[model samples]
Target: MRSKESDQTKEGSPSIVDSRFTQTLRNVQGLLKGRSFPGKVLITRLSGQLDESSIPPPAYLRSFSDSDVGPIELDNTFEDGFQSRSNSNASSSSSKMRTLSNTEAMSDQVQKSTMGARAIDSARLMKFTKELSTTTVILERLRELAWSGVPHQIRPKVWRLLLGYAPPNSDRRDGILRRKRQEYLDCAAQYYDISDMDRTDEEISMLHQIAVDCPRTVPDVAFFQQAEVQKSLERILYTWAIRHPASGYVQGINDLATPFLVVFLSEYLEGNVDGWSVADLPPSTISDVEADCYWCLSKLLDGMQDHYTFAQPGIQRLVFKLKELVRRIDERVSTHMEEQGLEFLQFAFRWFNCLLIREIPFHLVTRLWDTYIAEGDALPDFLVYISASFLLTWSDELLKLDFPEMVMFLQHLPTQSWSHIELEMVLSRAYMWHTMFNNSPSHLVN
Candidate 1:
C-alpha cells in the first residue's frame, strides 16, 4: 500500500478491470496534427478553435479529403470565402507567432552559441529546437489568455493561433483548419437556415435521414486532419446521446470527443452506427454526421461506462468514497483546509467536473494524460494523485491560510499552481505514499 506518489516507492501488482478505456486517448492523439494530447478543458478549448485563424493551411492538409467535411458540392463554394478574411485579423496572429518563434530560436542559438555547431546536429534536433522556441512563445500567449480568462466562445481562434494553424475565415490557401471552420460555419448557417418554401416536412425529414447516413457512404479518414472532424465528432456525440436517450450527451463527453476529433476525425467519420439521425441535412450528398456521432460516443463510453450509471448509480457513492480516500490519504491537509472553513464543493467542483483539467497545468495535464492512458481503469489513481499532489505541495501554504483566503484561493485557483515539476513529483510519489500508509501497521488518521 505504498503511496503512488512516493519517491522511494516500488511498483505493485497492476489493477484489473481491463484498463484500455483510458488508453484509447493515446491512439487518438497519434492521429491528430499536434505534437501532444491535451486533457479535457484544454482540448475542448482547442477543438472549438483548432481552425479559427486565417494562416496558411498546414502542409498536412492534403492528407484529409474534401469529403471529410461531410457533404461538399463539386465547387466547394465556401472555400473561396473563407480565405478572404480581412488582413487586419490574420496579421496579428501571423506576425505575433513569427516574432515569438524567431526570438525563441535566437535565444536558444545564443545560449548554445558557446557549444558551437555541434549542438544542432540532426534534422530532428533542428526540429525540436524550432518547436521548443515555438513552445515558449505559444506558452506565453496561452498564459496571457488564460490569465484574462477569455470567454470560451472566442477560444477557438486563440487555439488556431497557438498551433500556428490558419484561422477559420482565412483563404483556403492558408490551411485546412481555417478553411474547414469557415466551411463548417457556412454549412451550419445554411443547414440551419433552410428555405421552408423549397422543402416540405417530408423533405426535411428525408434530409435529416440523409445526413445520418452520409458517413456510411463516404468512407474518408483524411477528414480527421481538418475542422470537419471536430464538427462531425460533436454531431456524432449529440446524436448518440439523443438516440440512446438513456445516456443523453453529458458535458464531459464533449470534452472527451473534442480532442479525439481533433486527432482522429478521419477514423471516426469513416465508421457508421445504427439509429443514425441525418434527417436535417442537404440532399443526396449530405453527411451522416449523426451516425458517426453516435459511433464515436459509443466508442468514448466504451471504457468508462460505470462512471455514468444513471437513476441510482454510483454518483454520490463515488463522491463519498473519494472523500474517504482523501481522508485516509491526507487528513492533516484536509482537516487544515476544513478548519479554514472552506466548503469542499467550492473549489473542489472543478476537480471532479472536468476531471482535474483546471487543477493541473497544461504540461502536467499532458503528463497526467500520458499516465492516464498508460493506466486505464485507474480513475482512483488519477483522483488520488490530484488530491495527494494538492495536499503535499500546498501544505505549506495551507497551514498559513485563515479560512476566507483559503477558499478564495481555491475557488479561483490558477492552473500555474499545479506546476509541471510539482506534478511530476506528485505523480511519482503520491501512490507510493498512499500504499505505504495503507500498509503501515498502526497508522492513525492525522
Candidate 2:
C-alpha cells in the first residue's frame, strides 16, 4: 500500500548495494528469457532460489516426446494456488487460448491435446460445479480457472460466475440469467422509450454522446460496425450512464463494453469467430449478448466507479503509481521520459480508462482479461504494474524518441498484430515485476 515515490525516497543512498541487487535480478531474468517452467518452479527461481533443484531444465532438455503427455504436478505457490489438470486427452482443436497457453506455456508443451466445442475437460467442469456447490471455495476455484484463462465454451458461464451475474448455484443459474436479462431489457426499454418531453437535458445529452461514440467503439471490427450492434452499445452505455449518473457515458467506458460483448457472444460461436457478423445471428441472440454485456460492464465498473467519476481521481492515482513504479524499476527510462517533459498521464490515461483495450488486439484482450477478472478487486492496482511493464517493454524504442516521437510511439506501439505470445510475455513480465516490487521496498534509488 506504500507509494512507489515514498519507497524510492526511503531507499536513501544505496547505490552500490542497489546496483548489485539489480544486476543479480537482471542476470536471473536473462537466464529465464524464453524458458518456460512450472508456476511453482518459476516463482521459486525468480524469488532467488537458485539451487539445482529449483533451477529449470536447460534448453536442450526441454524437448519432450508427444507421448510424454501426463498430469502436471503443480506447485501450490502459484498465483491462484490451484493444481492444474493436464489436458493431454482433450482434443487440441477444441482447445481455445486457455488450453493453448495453459498446457504449452505452463508445462512447456507437455500436453497439446485439443478440445472440441462444448467439450471442455469433464473433470474440470465437474470440479468447478462441485466447488461452486460448496459456496466457500467457489471464488477460489473460479480465480484459478479464470487466471489461467477459461476454456472458450465455458467462458460465458465462467464470466457470469465471476461477475456474480449468475447464481453460483447451478440449479438457480438459468432462472437468474433469465431474470437479469429481462431486467436489462426492461431498463433498455425504459431509457429508449422516452418521448422528448419525458427526458431531461442531461439524459438527452448522455444519449447523444453515447450515440456518437458507439460507432467509434470498435470501428475496425465488423460486428461492432453493424447498425444493430451500434444501437446495442448505445443502449448499454446510456442505460449504465443513466443508472450511475455521476460518471455517465465516458468515451473509454465504450471500450470496456467490447470485451464483455465479445466474450458473451463467443458462447454461441463454434471457433475463431472474431470476424463473424452479428447481423447473421438472431435478434434474441444479439439482445442476450447485449444484455449480458451491459450487466457485466456494470459489475466491472462498480468497483472502480471513481475512475469514471468527476475528475477521474482513480485514473490519476493509477497514473501516478505507474510513474512511481517505473522510476523505481527503470530510472533511466524514467529520466529520459522526464527530460522529454513526458508524464505518465499523457499515455496512461487511455491505458487506465480503457484497461488497455484500445492498445491491444481484441482476441488477446480477452486472454488478458482472464487474469484481470480473476484478480477481482485488485484489478485497478494490478493494472498499474501491467501498464508499467507494457510501457517499459518498449523502453529501448521509447528512450530513443524525442517528445513528439515518444508521444506517437506510446500511442501506437506496434502491438496491432500481437497474439497470445506477446500478451503472455507482457503478463509474465508484469507478474515478475509485481512480485518483486509491489509492496516491497525498492532496493535502488531513482
lDDT of 1 by residue, 244-339 (tens): 445454444444443323222222322332222333335322343233223333543554565454642333444454455555544556678667
lDDT of each: 0.41, 0.71
Reference-based TM-score, model 2 = 0.77
Error of 2 at 107 (Å): 22
Stretch of 10 with least lDDT, candidate 2 = 60-69
Clashes of 2: 9
lDDT of 2 by residue, 275-333 (tens): 66676789888888888998888888888999999899999999988888888777878
Instruction: Give all TM-scores, in the order shown.
Output: 0.41, 0.77
Best by lDDT: 2
Q: Which stretches of model 2 miss by more than 4 angstroms?
A: 1-17, 35-49, 52-137, 441-446
